[model samples]
Target: MSDFQCHPKPKRLTWAEAACFMVTGPTAYRQLFGWPGNVVKPGEVVLIWGGAGGLGSMAIQLTRIAGAIPIAVASTDERAKFCLELGAEGVVDRTKFDHWGRLPDTTDEAGMNHFHKGARAFGKAIWEILGTRQLPKVVLEHSGQDTLPTSMYVCDNGGMVVICGGSTGYNGDVDLRHLWMRSKRLQGSHASNFREYREVIKLIDAGLLQPCLSACGTIEDVGLYHQLLHENLHPSGNMAVHINATESGSTELA
Candidate 1:
């Protein structure tokens, strides 16, 4: 392991909490701030794709701390509630929309119209939450193939959609017109560097960020967990498994 990989846990955090945030926090940070030509500015609207998921959850907190408004796209009402609880300015229930997936060719009138209609409605949903016509300045993307086009459609002009992983599929459709005409960017990102990791931990240490640990399991459950994740049937929020780490005598007697 490299020296940059090791981070000290803040005393106020449980092992589960620290572990839950260790990866997602920095990734989210990098998505918002570390990416080229896509740094999130104060008061910007950041639309997070997986609002209740691990990355989305952390992005919401980091966005707020950066003086930006965070809106989350969630699948369920329960998840929407969770996002709002985490200080999301708004949460859009993604289940209502059916126009996700690869885009049709530009000349395909019907397909393009239907897709545009649905995308506009999606943007309207965000406007409804914001009480304004302004769209997200930065869209945090992970569901690649299905939602990428819509993300491009709704993002504000000159804004960016920073993508980390493609959970839905790899082949996301992008209209080059959106790039040259609107001056928008679709940026790809991955894990953050050590500086980004340490910055997020500083937020945790300052009590500004909450580690949203949804579940904890043992080493034996890792396989089952990954299977559930692949099927998208796992519980929301981040999960942690203790590997060679014992919980015994770790908590103070209260």
Candidate 2:
């Protein structure tokens, strides 16, 4: 049978790494290069939400490869370290702030003030990491309700916020005043196409990218793994199960 999905494995990728690369790698590549109209350019800043997970890991390296500055948002020290190891210019500890969810209406002065204070602090954190007052040209977003408002707020004028999933709640708010006044773009993308996938594979083959898989387990641990993931206790990067083989790649990294 002819299979379009089959591609020659990269020289540096193991079977487990290949599995990790196939999805997140291509999706990330397209997000930075093809999907968004405001694609990432060299030397531009790119803010990536969930920067320690499967997609975020790929986004970090891909952004680095593209010559863009990548700042990752992570919740823990370990996760933040993982992003840094993957070449993120900086890592934001999301747990430090609490201003999340929908932006409060203008009528609620107290709520708005609290939100603004937290949001500005978070934005300032980005500036601190960057060592300058510039904003991100592109925001890689999979987080939805909790971070979208801030992403829109800190994105550079006429920048793009490209999203693929909502691991968090789906109700996200975009502050239209800044969005319209600054001419920002919010673009939605799905899984990558063949060309995108092929490019990722080639990059892996040439050693310009890594799979960044964090762990592997037997099929019996699927329930436990999913539980860990849902509870946000899973390791950084991709996690895979040994379907028919005894082992595949590095078993743990978090």
Please report the candidate that would top lDDT against the real structure. Answer: 1
Off by over 4 Å in 2: 246-254
Which whole-number lDDT from 0 to 100 does residue 55 have in model 2?
Answer: 90
Q: In model 2, what is the error at residue 207, expressed in angstroms?
A: 1.0
Q: List model 1 lDDT by residue over 133-248, tens digit each.
A: 88899999999999999999999999999999999999999988887799999999898888999999999989999888887888998999899888777676788887776662
Instruction: Please identify model 1 stretches exceeding 4 Å from their true place.
Output: 248-254
Using alpha carbons, what is the TM-score of model 2? 0.94
Clashing pairs in 1: none
- Over 176-236, each residue of candidate 2 has an lDDT whose tens digit, in order, gives 8888999998888888988888998888888888888788778898999999989989999
- lDDT, candidate 2, residue 41? 90
